[model samples]
Target: MDTAMQDRALGAVLAGACGDALGAPYEFGPPLVAEQPVEMRGGGPFGWEPGEWTDDTSMAIPVLEAVANGARWNETRTHGRLLAAWSDWAQDAPDVGAQTRAVLGRLTANTEDAARAAALAVHEQQGRSAGNGSLMRTAPLALGFLGDGGKRPLAVAARRVSDLTHHEDDAGDACVLWTVAIRHAVRRGKLDVRRGVPLLPRERRTLWLDRIAEAEHSAPADHTERNGWVVAALQAAVSAISTGDGLVDTLERAVRGGGDTDTVAAITGGLAGALAGASALPEQWTVLVHGWPGKRLDWLRSLAVRAVDRTPGPLGMPVRRS
Candidate 1:
């Protein structure tokens, strides 16, 4: 990989961990004004120690690990390992979304078509199953696709990964767009939040454009950007990226935006960090934040770099020519 993309990949992972840990202490609480620059304090509703990341990064790490280990599109080995990791994590993860909890529960108990069966059950139980569950951990999918994939591979990998725990069209669609945004930021040095619109199905495109409009132009009174809803989370994270002046401030804005704060901030951080590169992050923040799966920032950085270098996905190519 070129020096620029490599740095951006490193930036994505570190800043994501940083944002996840920074927002951990204030997950569902009212947004707090920073009396000072944000710190990675623990003890949110989950109550882990300082610098510990939450379910957002915990779930994401499995994907990153599998990708770094060379898991590609529709590859059962990676998916199975990810499922096993989810089952193990359920035993002790500090927090899990309702959709993810349901899906993982079924995956643990049954071996046949676990992802589809679990999602089908959830759909039957609840008329709709759209949540931010799958979207939060999808960044690595993009990194894996960066080698020889384009819009089609990205869309396919995104929906398939999301179906493991979330089945709603909106959730799957959000994952595709967000992953594309991350890739765009890494390669091009900026986010095109609407890049997914042209790639979306016709019906979803119209709905999404309307949704994006509401989210993009939302005033605080509108409350378009808050909570576990996939649309709100996507909108909030993208809006924060578009508006903030730098990586740190962008993350700070996402956390202070309130409602599902950690997820939103982590998502935003991944995008902004990719565009800004690791140098954009505060050194102290990277030094403090880490994965609960026992990965420090440097470990996460290496995993991210590997994901970009290997893991060609369905296309079978390297990230760059040697």
Candidate 2:
């Protein structure tokens, strides 16, 4: 990838984390009024430190790690590794989505089959599993699959990965669509959530296209009440990205929608970051963003690049301890 494309790829990961941290304090809070001030204030129900990311970004780290290890995303071994990593992380995660917590907590074995079965059981038990948890962690998967022509592999891999913890077809479809959109934005520097609609199952394309259109024409608030659902969450993220002028403003717009503020903003951040590039992220937010696995801003930067480069060598990104 060229420097510009690389920068956008880096942005997708870094800005997603930054957005997670920036919106952390506002999660489940009332929607902000238009032009209301926003900052990385932290101290939400989970008591996150200022600039500390939540599970949205924390869950993405395993995807990045799998890509950096050169693991093919569709393989069982790859799924096993991701499941094991997530299981370990959830053991102490301050806040995990109810759907994710249920699925991950039920795992008695860390294998891919076990994870999938657990996910399926949970979905059957509840009769609904279309949660935003899968989509939030899906951005990094796109970077790993950018090399595949036609992006077919990218779509398949996205659904497979989503299925590990989210059995709902809507959740899997959302991942495929958003991941494809992120891949396109990084490659072309444009925001088009609809760019991935054609990649959806033939029966589902028009439905997603209409959803994308609805998001474009609506405000983020339209989806905030149900943003925990994968489709509504995707809509809120897309609405913010399509309506706002830039990455920061888009994230702010997402936060203003309230409810699952951090998840919505993190979702918006991945696409906005892909379009605007890492340099477009605010220095203030980037400097303070930190999260699970002892990751700081520098680790996320390196992980983003390494996932794209698929380089297993020494860290290419400079280490900046915050």
Candidate 3:
């Protein structure tokens, strides 16, 4: 890949991580002005404090690692790698959702029916929950499988990885849509979610809506939250691109929009980064973010090259000859 494309990929990764770290401290707050650190602490609560990313990015890293190492779809090896990564992150035990933590705990115990039981428990308790967790970690799937000339194969692979924990049809479908959308955005530098939403086909959309409605209907009556809010995240991402807004603004809107802040910010930020590239990010924010970083930034840069370099052209050949 050329320098420009490489930089774009790196930018996407950095943007995603930076967004996650910046939004972490204010995951649950009001829409207008979410609580952040005091200005004396660096003009923001988490600023200058070496922002720490949560499970959103943690889960994504292994997905990239697995793809880079050539893990196949639905394979036990791939699933095991994902589980092992979750285990490693679980050891540190950062602030994670109750449902996610419980699933991880069971997986760690090495129980006989750990995987099945965990999936069932999440589905039962959450009623086929379709949160943004699946979408947040799906960027790599887009980057990894782009131009592979097999959307079905790629979607199946990405879905298996997503379904390791989130098995709901809508969640899985959303994960696929987000992944493919990012791939197109990164490659072409643009995509229309509104246009793409309808392209999902009636049957598929109905399937997704069904699962979402099931989760919503099964949800306690006290729950007034809208499951369609997840679509709001997708809309927010598309709006960021259409309106030419910066990554931070887009991410802030996603987070403050409420209901699954981190995941929404993560998915939105990932798409924005892929569309806008690293240069689109604010220099000050990038410097601050990269300053405290390790392989997260470096891997992002490398993966960007890989993303462009891997796109296949006519007759399954590489489109751009490096």
Name the best candidate (by TM-score): 2
TM-score per prediction, in order, is 0.92, 0.94, 0.76
lDDT of 1 by residue, 46-147 (tens): 886787788888888888887787776666556667778888888887688878887777663434267778888887788888888888888877777766
Candidate 1 has its poorest 10 consecutive residues by lDDT at 218-227
Kindly give the number of clashing pairs for every candidate.
0, 0, 1
Give the higher-lDDT candidate: 1 or 2: 2
lDDT for each candidate structure: 0.77, 0.86, 0.57
Residue 6 in model 2: lDDT = 85
Higher-ranked by lDDT: 1 or 3: 1
lDDT value, residue 141 of candidate 3: 68
For model 1, the stretches where C-alpha displacement exceeds 4 angstroms are: 33-37, 108-112, 219-226, 312-322
Which candidate has the highest lDDT of all?
A: 2
- Stretches of candidate 3 off by over 4 Å are 2-4, 33-50, 108-117, 148-150, 194-202, 206-232, 239-244, 256-259, 290-296, 303-316, 320-322
Model 1 Cα shift for residue 251 (angstroms):
0.2
Residue 147 alpha-carbon offset, candidate 1, angstroms: 3.1
Candidate 3 lDDT, tens digit per residue, 1-322? 4555555455556677767666565555344343543111122232334455666777777776666555565467667767777767767544555555667766744332466467667778767556556667777766555554645555666667666666566666676676666666665666534223344546787654444344333311111244233444444444434443566666665555544455556676787787777777765555544322244455555654554455432124443422
The worst-scoring run of ten residues by lDDT in candidate 2 lies at 313-322
When 1 and 2 are scored with TM-score, the better candidate is: 2
Residue 172 lDDT (model 3): 68
